[model samples]
Target: MSEISREILSVGDLNRAIASSLEERFDAVWVSGEISNFKAYDSGHWYFSLKDEEGQIRCVMFRGRNGQVGFVPQSGDLVEVGASLGLYVPRGDIQLTIQTLRRAGMGGLYEAFLKLKARLAKEGLFDLERKREIPAHPRSIGIITSLQAAALKDVLSTLARRAPHIPIVIYPTLVQGPEAPSGIVAALKSAAKENAVDVILLVRGGGSIEDLWAFNDEQLAYAIAQSPIPIVSGVGHETDTTIADFVADLRAPTPTGAAELAAPRRDQMLQELAAIEQALSQRIHQRVEREAQTLDQFALRLSHALPNPERMREQIQHWQQRLKQAWLVRVDSWSRNQSHYAQQLEMLNPQRTLERGYAVVLNAKTGLQAVRNPDELNTHSAFEIRLADGVANVKFAELESRKS
Candidate 1:
């Protein structure tokens, strides 16, 4: 009765359908396996195979996602991955697109870390207001770390290079193992008791969560929070975070970074000082210039307010010339008046009248008396007549008188 209708799929269609099915059917999953054939490319992508005893699967971690893993993965390392299952359409192969990767047994440690972080955060240990400001120029810097630890050497070198003038005090302590927390706390207490340092650096090198677990201790966090001097925590690499980092006043990415934060660079400080000196000089110069300009303006105003010497001298000269002309006019008028008076006195002189043909008469007996009328003269008396040149004498001849 019949050949049933069947659907045939092409290879590309089959692969795409399978990929879609795998992606749709599975959410993100956690898988435990040992890594093998772990190859990292220049592009920063990782391609590896994850296998247990019986089965294996291919996996890939891209650069954008893998940097958060904190540690590089090696072949034969046991790891747990959170990933999504998918099929590669080109190869038609099943694979995992990994989102997160960690050491297999570290799940519990990570969980404990999260819980402790949350608890401490709720207690306000990470509050910004409680934090101290790091001194910009610390008098002395203290370091809390193991003497044998490489982190100590790194910190010492960094401090020496950046700020050679500042003194450094090392409080050597255990940085690992079960006893590390108590050792760190004791060192911190000792540093606080001394009260000699302006800032303290708590440093350690990079390691796995197990190796760095001491820094996550609750006691260490409290010690960091209660420290009298400000603390800078630099435990592990940049990606590693511990409770000490959260509780400290400042957090640095590495041991060297902690030293740099605690000690200011000498060269940079000198540059800043030079800049400040220049600015102060400029301000002083500006103030002097303003004062000088004001003085100049006052001088100009004073010059306008006072009289000019040259103009006063010119006015005096003009008045002197007027006075000289007036004196000359007065002297000329006096000369003219004297000449007129002299001419009038000449006109009134008796010698001038005598020179005009006039004569004077006087009595002969008394030569000083003049005879004016015939009645005064005796009939036989003599009289005298005086002229300009000579005098004459005469006698009366008749006794007749002329009536007027």
Candidate 2:
């Protein structure tokens, strides 16, 4: 064999090379073990060693990351952490730089939570269109929660303050442990069957993921979705969410918030009613004024349209005077005509001619015929001569034929 090639390196250089290699090879990884030698500095940084019976690993969670851990870890607490392997150049020792931390079993629970959430979301349980609207003015309210839960007091007090007139129904049930999901479902069914409440509130106090895991049950989510009455879920704190929250008709940040949303405030409703009354009164007043104005205009038009009685009387008197003048002229003309005709009749009277002494001659043989020629009187023929009142018989003494 050829002489072995030799490369000499200082301790710091050696440790830097090892640290770089470990980081490049491992990336971030999760490891589980019981915590030991845990330490907290004033800077809020956490230093600890994770160990099991067979092996142990040194770990450090910086201040920036550990602040979000949500709890201070004690020695011998089982924890799982996501960390990158590295060698501390200063100490020249292997260690892990923790980026995340959680209780050992939380990882599995979180994974299940994500899986169920995805499946239910794909089935349209979380669709916005499927959600119902909470009644603005519910006649009654139902509460489904643990009787021992502190959240119950909060919701009750809030509803009482906002809408005391509304009736409240409580359906007590377990909010945790293995039996919580079924208990909640039973209470929901009872409330639905009774149908006494317009809205239902599903509430629980704040807790860790494990403490609140019962709300994540698949059956409870389905039950909430199937309820006919609108459900308002107020589970855990604002940051805490579960499957029931997604399936409920509405999600409130807190139990008090659910109560507030379920019932309308009495004082606020009164204000709205007052405003409506005022608007109606104003509209009625305006309508009446408009009608009164229209009536006044009609009255003015009627005064002009009606005929005057005084003018009618004057017209009648003028026609009467003209008629009287025509009648008098006709009467005078008729009386003059009658007087002229009477005078003409008197001039033509036959008795007046007889009184003038004219006499009628008649043949004496019949004593009724008048003689017109001298031949009727041959020698000694008798004839009657009649004056106005007497007749006398006479004979012709001498006959002379000289007159024609």
Candidate 3:
């Protein structure tokens, strides 16, 4: 060994040198391990230990790098980390500064999917309001999938069984592999340009994350959103979900399901039409019966309300006769009363009483009676004596007093 290399070095200096050498050798390497003793500081840095059955290493993921992680990590989770080896100068401990941390296998894809979903959702791509409603009865359907895909077969069989009258136009494209997303996007655009189909069915058979990754493409999702045609995404099995599913106008569980959604059963429509016809017939029959009854009532009312001049004149004459009779009776009663009252008045009248040998004397000037008592009489009195046929005048100088 060289004498310089043999010289003693402090622990910090040695750790720094070792760290530099380790980074130089493996600046970026993938390490697979389970996490333990995870700690997230207020500074947005993550400190943890990556461990295996027999070995472990200290790791740190700073705020800048970990912010890109869509999810928080838990202890004991299996993870794959891309990092560089480093040592803490203060403690002289071997550690890794994680540049990227991903859950192993499909977890990485899930994280990316979640990230894109959040971004697109915030941008309103997956808004329920923006989603186009699928037609209840599409005249024709455009399918974008590989012609050899089992999904195509399933969809065709379902459509044929459910609604044989509806025609289908297939826009064939790759559904898997790296080039699949662009191909699928092109097919969608072509279908939209054709404008022949009421709705577009974007479908594929279920597969692994890698195989279905094409459906998760951001551009493909945007294309589906902007397409003039409504798209039903049936890209995978019931449990599988992709970015296309969210951005699509509708998501079906399988290709057959998408066919069912797009096409209404012919038998069901026939039954509905029959029901409507029967209901209309019943409503018309009831309305006709009701109107006939109303017409009969109206005829009766019209017959009653019809004017007859002869009958009206007869009624008027009858009323007039009755009124005349009533007036005559009243006149007779009044005549009888007048005759009876005239007899009474004649008997009571002073002139008539005078004719009956009784007289009424009243003061001539005032035409009032004077006192019969001599003590109350005026010395000179003038009176009008009323007789049966004429009036008589009398004067008296004194009143006569007679002893009993």
Candidate 4:
């Protein structure tokens, strides 16, 4: 060995030098690729890989900084990542430490999902006000899921165990695979057409993100959001959440949980019914007792105040005598008044005067009284003379005048 140059470098000094060099040269870098191996740790740290069609780079998202970013990073998600190139001191491996992440491919399904989510959120579709209350007692429950899924079996078993009496309509359809999205949409549409269910339960078993992808479809989310009936989403296990969960009226952690929530428990209902019946019985008994006491009081009063039949008869006879005496006095007064009025009416009767041989005359032609003046009578006119019960028609034969 010729001349060996020695430089003492501590681990901290080396890391500091590497970090400073990275900060100076690659402080603000924009890398665009699809997100992969995304992992959010409990320590509020994220570890992921950003990959393109050809290659990929490992990245880490620390909690302190990534928490500020607006969107969440998911596996297979295309995102634009801003990060610093740094070496992990222990491993001495260079990795991209992401500061911010945004969705990649400005014109892809991911972009559409974000855009629709934003639009729907702005329209208040995701608002609590738009959510409907789940029916406490569903008369009929509708289920939209795959016919052969384990989720269907779980839901049915839960419903059967919890609310066996409730009628159920199974609108079966594919919940996975290529056709699952359209199948689910059609199933929901068919269930709506029946219009028979009080509530709808859209459920599927727990699976990986790819397995639950159908529930994340935009069309499926919109359908659930626009469903006429209230929907309960139990798409996956407790840890997994999808867009359906947000849009559904209610979200259950599991299929069994969905069934339990969709309707009330039979035992609880029975207990409630028993309580109501007991209250009604108690009220009825109290009312009957009250009415019976009232009747007994009435009976006692009737027994104590029984009337004397002979005394009542004698009192009635006395009233009858008084009524007869009053009627005789009224009859005598009426007879006296009637006779006086008859005499007065006899004096004023025109027919009675006519019957006493008085006569009246009238001219026929102007229907006026016959006149003795010659100027007052026309020769062509007729006249009438009246006695008690007869009248005589007469023509004016000659004019007679009387000077007054």
Q: How do the residues 311-386 of candidate 3 rate in per-residue lDDT, one tens digit apiece?
A: 7556655755675566567656755765675576345423454577765565644324333444544546677766
lDDT, candidates in the order shown: 0.84, 0.82, 0.80, 0.77
In what order do the candidates fall by TM-score, top score first?
Answer: 2, 1, 3, 4
Q: Candidate 1: where are CA atoms >4 Å away?
A: 1-106, 306-404
Per candidate, the number of residue pairs that clash is 0, 1, 2, 1
lDDT of 2 by residue, 21-119 (tens): 999999989999878778899988899898888999899999999989998876656788999999999998799999999987434567788899999
Q: What is the TM-score of each predicted model, taking all chains together?
A: 0.55, 0.56, 0.52, 0.49
True-vs-predicted CA distance for residue 303, candidate 2, Å: 3.6
Best by lDDT: 1
Q: Taking the tens digit of each residue's C-alpha lDDT, what string does model 4 give over 41-136?
A: 899899988777799888998889887887666676767878889877777667898878776653244565667668767867678888999989
Tens digits of per-residue lDDT for model 1, 1-404 = 23433767889999999999889999899999888888899999999999888999999999999999998886666799999999998898899999999987434567689899999999999999999999998888989998788998899889879986676777879999999999999999999998878999999999867789999999889989989899999999999899999999999999999998888887887677567656755665576568556655655665566588566556555755675566567656755765676576456445576678986556655422445566777767777866777778877777777857
> lDDT value for candidate 2?
0.82
Using lDDT as the measure, name the better of candidate 1 and candidate 4: 1
Model 2 residue pairs with clashes = 362-370
